[model samples]
Target: MIRRVLACSVALVAVCSLGGCGTLPGFGDDTTEVTVWLMRNSASDDFVQRFKHGFEQEHKDVELDVRIQEWTGIGEKIDQALKDGDAPDVIEVGNTQVPRYAASGGLLDMTLESLRDWGSDAWLPGLAQPGNVDGMQYGIPWYAANRVVIYNKDLFAAAGITKPPKDRAEWLADTAKLNSGQNQGIYLAGQDWYTLAGFVWDEGGELAQEGTGDWKGALDSPAALRGMAFYKQLQALGNGPRNADEETPPQAGIFAGGKVAQMIAVPGAAKAIQKANPRLADKLGYFPIPGPTEAKPGAVFTGGSDLIIPRRTAHRAAAVRVVAALTGEKWQTDLAATMNYVPNKSTLAHAVEGQAGTAAMARGAAQGRATPNSPQWAAVEADNPIKPYMTSVLNGADPKRAAKAASDRITTLLFP
Candidate 1:
């Protein structure tokens, strides 16, 4: 296991200091080289170059070597690097991956630094809470992206819907009006659990609850069942596959076919729709998923990246500085503007004021929530029972029994 390899390097963490470490081959003795591994497409090359120039101007003694890595098989790559004691000083990982790495004791504890310099209190709860594993902050939130209702403007107009829904009731009403012969109101797949997670959270239900030392699935709870009931009611409005997810045949391609009126996706999906069928380039619009009431937007799963410093990095201080710069207000604002991402902190929403899609995403992210903060959560996802449970419910199975069965599987995986 990766933990075994990471555990062996715990002793080197204390001695890995910037000034005390040996220099890299290309850098002079006076320079501290900080290597960063960012996921592909997270930032544009131009934006990275701009950051490098600006950061290097401020810290002349440090050289930033930023490398973009592909997402496929990244977990194993990261594990291997940690095992070899050759991990990058800073790495960008999914927010959900924090617990697994932090639990392995291969991450630098940044609780003090987060509180002292990064203003930990104001960060978005969805992005912030997952990083705070066992009361210690390991992942520093970089940027966030969540699902929104990407709709066809022409379809809404044709249906006489003057505006987007302000609440779940209105959304259902609007979708029903838009769903007619040969047209789908919304292409919401039955097993799209990330979207389902929002409804569960809206009803104040958790997918899994943390107990004394383990997690127990809570999908069988009354509130969660109510959320599932609502999902069933909405899924019947359109012709989404009950046994598949948004990506089975690529929902973006389906939406681009011009018969679907709406879909729940990140704003980035609009680009794909446009790419598939260029006619939708100017016909699309975005809005946050409406909540049960108009008081707030629906809760969404905040999917985004976080920056981490490996425990065995030679340039620990330089890595910390690099993380600070990336998560700082200046770069955060630039990143949001350039990439249309929600800033790490809710206070930075103003950065994307004029961008409609990102603005809607930011609003939903205000009430966003992450998955269960357990090291075994990743394993649960790998062999996910929730998808089949959703399908079973949609296919006429008893909700309570299906939920109970899925919950049992979850408990076993979470505590395995």
Candidate 2:
């Protein structure tokens, strides 16, 4: 009986050892899982699904949990998660929101060594700017998108314009010519903040400037005033959308129907327009936003989502691996082709060449600039007073007076 019992004990021990029943948990343990939080954007959803499936398939022992959060309530959700100690291991955050989250210690400082180890340095400088706060890296560039002047070639020809405008004056003249009965010359989406920012940067002015350990408002400068005045002049030219609220559908519908001449738009709209009217795909033309001065064409704002590691994650290594996979060349190449975004890496630009409207956007990304990296930037921008002030300026409000009021309001917000 003693000998039989010893043999049974030995067999049990072997079984347990092979099954990992008595080992201290280490990296890649069977029970280890990574949770990723992301925005519910069209691009992110596609990337996450593919990435999760591929990574989990390759690593059978590991599991991935994805949580999609609405963008409107993401900030509050992140804050709540962090407070409750239930934050995701990896997160997809807006490029502009990086500074705010980093400042609040909501994100982990991903070192340069990690980027080098993952071979992510090949991405363009502008794409990586969002992840760098105060010279420290905390996020990775997943993908990027930029605004460009999309025009209907048919409308241009009808207006007797042989070529797209190469400078601001030409754009103005062209818009005036396109402004005919019920067929507006241009479609300026005044209520869209992103579009307004493009115009602001084109005039060689910025919303904020680097100050002593923070950012100060600069929207009231002469250059910005001039830019606003130009937008107002254009708004007066025809029956364009009154604000950005009504601008997108009407402009897109009109352009696809061959009524409007040109407008500023993102790359995603290209595919939508093509789907709406297949013939317009071939008729569409893209150009960089023209600057006020001949020497410096206007710059468009860089807006896109980025990958981050929340500080509260339990599976750091797994989360890092997930981020690496999502931002890797293979995934980025595929994403750029499907989503019409500029690949984060310049080398990946070639993957999206044959796609409509992407080549011009890639060119624009190579030459675009980012908004000021400040935690308070969103607040200052969202102030109700500023938009109306801009609307007033766009409606032929005095440049100096409108600028003064905007400057004063921004100054109070920043300084206070």
Q: Which residue runs of candidate 2 sit more than 4 Å off their true CA positions?
A: 1-31, 44-47, 57-61, 118-126, 241-250, 254-257, 270-283, 292-297
Q: How do the residues 287-363 of candidate 1 rate in per-residue lDDT, one tens digit apiece?
A: 99999999999999999999989999999888899999999999999999999999999999999989989999999
* Candidate 2 pairs with clashing backbones: 179-185, 191-244, 202-298, 291-297, 291-298
Candidate 2 per-residue lDDT, tens place, 1-416, comes to 99999998798778766765422344225455777777776465666778788889877766888877788888878777766878888888877778778877867777764467755566655557767888778878887888787888887888899976777888788888888876778776665556566677777787777777756667688777766767777666656555443355555765677676777788667676787789887888887677675564466677787788887787777787888877888888888887788887777889878865787778667656666776776677667455667666666678678777777677667653
Q: Judged by lDDT, which candidate is best? A: 1
Each model's lDDT comes to 0.93, 0.73
Cα error of candidate 1 at position 178, Å: 1.1
> Where in model 1 is the C-alpha error above 4 Å?
1-29
